[model samples]
Target: MNNNIKRTLTTTILAAAFTVQAGENNFDQAYNSVSEADLRSHVKTLASDEFEGRQPTTIGEEKTLDYLTRQFTALGYQPGNNGSFLQPVELVRIEADPNVTLQIGDDSFEYKQNMVIGTSREQESVSLKDSELVFVGYGVNAPEYGWNDYAGVDVKGKTAVILVNDPGFANPDSGKFQGKTMTYYGRWTYKYEEASRQGAAGALIIHETAPASYGWSVVANSWSGPQYHLVTANGNKDRVAVEGWLSVEAAQTVFQKAGLDFEKLKEQAKNGPTAKAMSVKASVTVKSSLKRSKSNNFIATLPGSKAPDEHIIYTGHWDHLGKDPSKKGDNIYNGAHDNATGTASLISMAKAFASLKQRPARSVSFLIVTAEEQGLLGSKYYAEHPVYPLNKTVANLNLDAMNILGRTKDVAVVGFGKSELETYLTKAAKRQGRIITQEDRPEAGYYYRSDHFSFAKKGVPALYAEGGAESADEESAKYRKKMKVILNGCYHQVCDEYRDSWDFGGIIEDTQMFFEVGYDLANSDDWPKWNKTSEFQRPE
Candidate 1:
């Protein structure tokens, strides 16, 4: 071969080799088109101190959604839902009675200091209203597992007390529920849903930071503000009558009075008998006022050339922990990593898709939801009122909290293998010299915690991937320690602010990999399926 021809052919071969082997490092050229810096900048701004922490149903909501809509418009993505970038998400805002009081006989406890309660009910005012209280051990009614906490009790118009997670969660060996891998039972939301379904006037979930995997202050900080929820024109079962969390000390005091061993009895419920209602034999009366309001969900879409009706969605909640005026230090819970990063990634991915010459075989929707901290409310609303039919929707790619802990050798994925989405992830991770690790604690129910669950419940496969918990530049021990620290501190706290010291390398890599996964799905003709045992599997 001539020298010039040989040199050109060799360069082409080398480029092809990089494409097939290590495209993760080719991030510059691979995403040569992607501007992660710009994405991060917008995310930083949205999650900045000025946004008031991006709380739903507030001015913060207005600024965050407006910016997102503008960005999507600039990127040439069409408004995803009905030509409107902003989809109104009506919610009933209910704050606990500031001077709220809880009582058992002569024992009375103060609000915030002791217990807090609120509801999704639309009534201008709602009171526990002299409702009799019943102790419902674990208060779970899992007919699928032949278990019923309300088996013989009549809590028709009373209050029920329940434990936090599922039975097998505390002790890893019991295996009744998804042991330690938080099943839906582990979620406090499920407890209230079951209570409301049973027509209970009120329901309280006992809180233990260890079991709940979060703190009670999480309750106080999260609820002590304007809450947002989906407002149904017809508000019956759509509303959860009375729902809130209780502190451990409070639960201990209440359980002590009934002469029942709360912790011990909880251990017993693991395998011996199905969970049952304890019947504290008391009544609760909570008088409170409510206000109704509406919020918006920002959506953008890239239509498919072949399967215009089929879709692959990317979603992130635009809301944050928000600032608490009373809290000391940094008042802003600027959720930079918690989700601003995720939402920003959605925008960047949309831009990349918009820049593509060949459109995907299936459509792509970028959704920025509201009120995620208020328990995935916006996504739930979308699931109920979808712009595109569920069956035609292929998959959901969810970004919640991405790791800012420098770059790592691996990227972890939650709910990694419940659906065919994992295959797409595997392909992307391979390029990054990383592999998808299943959530270390499945019992924590990380899968059900985010908006992705909204789609999973409707049979659309979903992937919620996170940047690695481990850091490559740091020692393995420190990497693990960093993981521990993030869980306890900064997560959902006012301290979760943006830092210039953060390593965007991992985030950039993760976003690109996420795009590649969705891109493959969007361009391919494959209809991913659920493994037979997956609870989310579609029925034949």
Candidate 2:
């Protein structure tokens, strides 16, 4: 069937389903089953120092799996993965040697200072020796947009130094590549992937704070530790030999050494210019220590009374940055706001679903995944090796970083207008006297950063929404300011630990809304769909 016909049929079915109303008292009981006290208890336990930051392949993962299993079993949910609650995800951990230097001509840059380098290839040593450096505009080869940075350049054995973000970011007024709202092409992951496809030996992204959305410290801390990737037969040998980032200061030095004007070249890139040879050779060696391990994605299901095959999936990642023992004083990266809150919200929602006297027509499942901090590994694995067929899966509702900063008058729908799932979110929010709003910082690409992206990439209609900036009561400006301070200071740091001062009212409200959204999806016979203009679409 054509896409338009399928969409029309689905819309008609959905409209008819909405005409009949389920008992309000039954839904009220389930919605009220989600409690702030339950959310707080789970967050306190998961984000505790005793969990060792919930790192995969550690004792932390074991504790987490055990806790989730016990909770689901108590809530009367059956194991979702066949008869087992756990789905094993094979992963390889590669920790690159930090005592290395990147040499660009006569100038050298220190690792974790001006440069952060690593390799996904499971090898003892990988090197790029005397490799010529080519400046590939945005390092984007997007044919759909009539832009190709590597149009004339053959970087087979050379290193490509690319700019961060896309050309649209540099010239937002040009109406190119979504114009400041970053597409998937703007991501550092995309740059590296494109470079590898062009057969580059190495790729380095020139980072700017405004474009990358985080400071150099984040790059240093995040890339310095052991990196994890899903195990492949070839051990990710298809990827570039070396992948890394260059601080703006280091990039400037390299540009000066090459006798090229960096600022002028950036302007030309915005107009779709081809790659430029920097006339500078680069050398770097990455010595890695590899470990192969297995992690589990916890899945529990409440089978429907009618259409048990069709499913509604709720996902929340349970992994964090783990602990850094090298740091002085407190070193644990207890990711309370980063994910522990999301993880807790999942357990709370599961309880609410289980409390429903008459189950929804479609099955509802809770998927608490591992290694999300390591680039959404668990969710990616599940999306690829799904226990329930992707075609049968109705929708994915992801909860990541729940709101703990009091009640809000609005909900922020990240990557809004992508899917029909937002219609359900809008209806649920209206019940709470709240409105749906777009995320404050769309350029940051919060949508692509979460577990839902894994499912969305495979054509699943996914929704990721949370509390917005507007306060429910009087302190609107003050609330916004305070939230900014708290989120900014604590993101990916040791300061992300749970606090007694947190207000769980917002978390409770958001969780309740999530419960309603999922319940609606579970009961409805119609499938949600991606918008026509969205890059993602259900496959024919």
Best candidate according to lDDT: 2
Q: TM-score, each model?
A: 0.89, 0.96
Candidate 1 whole-model C-alpha lDDT, 0 to 1: 0.74
Candidate 1 residue 309 C-alpha distance from true site, Å: 2.5
lDDT of 1 by residue, 479-517 (tens): 456545654566777777776656566677788888887
lDDT per residue for candidate 2 within 389-413, as digits (tens), equals 9999999999999987789999999
Question: How much lDDT does each candidate structure score?
Answer: 0.74, 0.89
lDDT of 2: 0.89
